[model samples]
Target: MRWINILLGLAVAGILGFYGIRELLADPVYFLELFLGGLVRGSIYALIALGYTMVYGIIQLINFAHGEIYMIGAMTALIVASVLGLWGWHSAVIAILAVVFAVVYSCAYGFTVEKIAYKPLRTAPRLSALISAIGMSLFLQNYVMLAQTPEFQPFESLIPDFAFWEPYAHIITSVELAIIITTVVVMILLGMLIKFTKIGKAMRATAQDKIMSSLVGINVNNVISTTFVVGSATAAIGGVLIACHVGQINFFIGFLAGLKAFIAAVLGGIGSVPGAVLGSLVLGISESFFTGYFWSEYEDVFAFTILVIILIFRPSGILGKHETQKV
Candidate 1:
């Protein structure tokens, strides 16, 4: 299976490269635009994927409601920003506060979701937990729709409108620059948290062996909550950035983005942070290039196709290592 997956991956790469080269030859200028779009979009996917991957890593359960958390984040940001506008206080500083509010709200929602929906099922069948996650997802989506209106809300970009390297090409926009920079900074901080901090050590220990970590006094529940908090916070940031870039968002946005991020998590190896990021980049870049140069109608189809190809070849996923269980 591994060999087959490797071969298929190579084949896909070759086919994509063939067409990509042709497209580049046809229009180098437009290709650059597609590349930039992919990079920014991929960062958003990576942010959401971190939440899906992290929860799975610690609890061995997929928190399907995570996408709704992303949605809630964006909703929170929009509400806050719009309210502040009513007070005649619209500025970059206010925008930053809106993001902070979103992050805090997301953290609370993440914790509450875990405690109410997942805590009781800690020792139950994994399937039960999975079902609960799906239920929570539906509930949140409707709850938000009723509370915040189902109509699409436009997000204001805090960064002033500007362009760089205009003469050379339509290189990068201000919002895209903000997103890429924010993602890079957040990823670096996440890496450091996982590596240097005491809580990071506890979380790693918990992920490795929950029973042993508990025996050694690691307060496993706290670590799990912390994981959700961090994951939710990042997803919140992703939500705000995505809203700003796209300029509009609806309640249903989370479902699609969540599915893509879930695929990315699986594609890159669900339990590995770096793998999640890598998968997101690959999916994002591939999707952009396909829609840009080929056919926009099949953009969503492209990610699923890659998912099927990857699953058929390697059930463990691109960066996932096979594990054996003993009875």
Candidate 2:
């Protein structure tokens, strides 16, 4: 199976490379611009994918409200920055701080959601748990609509414009650069925490088997809650970056982003961290290329089409493992 995956990957890469070479020959500058744009876009997707993968790893359940959590994070940051009267450099600092605060708040919300909605249903049927997730998602979305205005509002400018180094090509905006840098830093820190920390070990143990982990004296509930917190925090960061990039937000901001990030998670392999990153990059780059070379109308189609093909050929996902049930 691994060999099959390797071969398939090579084939796909070869096809893409061939087309890419043709495009480069036709218009090198344009190709470079598209590639950079894709990377920036992929950073946002990767940030959101972190949340989905983390929650799925620990609980084997998708937290559908994650997107809403992200939406809340952006709103929280925006509100906080506005309250602080932050603009330019000060505004940028406030925005970053606000995002950090939002992450903390979102983490708390995630922990609460797990305790209130998921923990009680842990021993229940899987379908019941799934329904609960859906209900929680709807509740969060509606809660925002009721508590906050549904209309789109512009985000306050936080960072001053920096001079562009690329005179011929202006592919990388300051917001795009910030998104890429922030995503990389967060991912690196997370990777380190998971790889070299005691809590990380506990998380891995709990993910493998909760009952066994509990029996072994691990605080299974705490680990589970921590997992949710981590996932939600990452999602919150993603939301902030996305809002800053687009310069607007609304009550339903999370719906489409969440769906896309979910697709990215599945495409990369749900349980694998690196898979999520790779999947996001592939999805982002593909979408950008299609939109750049073809038409914007086909952007969404291109992403979903790739997803369908991936599912048809590799149901377990590109880097996902297939679990065999013992009957």
Candidate 3:
């Protein structure tokens, strides 16, 4: 099965490369631009993907309101940056602070959501829990819309100019650099924490069997809450990055971003960290290519198509393991 997956991956890469070469033959610079755009977009997807993977790992339940959680992050960051920038703070510093605050607030929000909407259902039927999740998602969305005007607002001030000198040309954009650096750094720190720390082991054990973990003296509730906090914080960072990249925000911003991130998590393997990153990059790059080479209208279709294909071929996902039920 592993060999089959590897062969399939190689085959897919070959097909993409062949098409890319053909496209390059027609217009080389365009291809390069598309490639770069894909990488940037992929980083954003990876950030959001982390949130989904982390929460799913510990709870085995999908927090449908996660996207709304992300929206809160972006909305909060936008408000902070706008107010602070008006007060004469450096735009870069304001943006950074906004991101930090957004993450912290989002983490708190995640904890609250778990406590209010999920904790009670921990011992309930799976179907009931799922319905509750959907309800929570809708409630959060409408709550945001009611609290703030639903109209889209420009987030231009949050993005600062960044530049780098390259041998070929000078490429600069603080927004782009910020997204890449933030995502990479966060992923590295997360990877290290999960791989080397005691808390990470607790998380893994809890994921494998919450009851067993509790029996072994782990605080199951604490671990689960921590997982939600970590996931929400990462999603908040993703929201800020997306808002900066798009230069605008609306109450509905989280819907699509959350959907894509969820798809990325499934693609990578829901319980696998590296899988989420890979899935996110694939989704991001696919969307970029669709928008760049084909039509923007097809971007969503392209993303969903990839998800469907992955599901058909690898039902457990690229890096997911099959679980056995205890009789």
Evaluated with TM-score, which candidate comes out highest? 1
Q: List the residue pairs that clash in candidate 3.
A: 162-173, 162-174, 163-172, 268-275
Candidate 2 lDDT by residue in tens digits, 162-277: 66644532767787788888889989988987888988889998888888999999998888888888888888888888887889998898887887888898899997888888
Q: Per-residue lDDT for 167-282 in model 3, tens only?
A: 33324356676788888999999999887898888998998888999999999999989888988888898888888888889989888888888898998898789999998887
| Candidate 1 local distance difference test against the native | 0.90
TM match of model 3 to true structure: 0.92
- Give the CA lDDT, 0 to 100, for residue 141 in model 3: 86
Q: Pick by lDDT: which candidate is best? A: 1
Name the regions of candidate 2 deviating beyond 4 angstroms.
Answer: 1-14, 86-89, 163-169
Per-residue lDDT for 50 in model 3? 84
Models sorted by lDDT, best on top: 1, 3, 2
Q: What global local distance difference test value does model 2 have?
A: 0.84
Worst 10 residues of 3 by lDDT: 163-172
The parts of candidate 1 lying over 4 Å away from their true place are: 1-6, 163-169
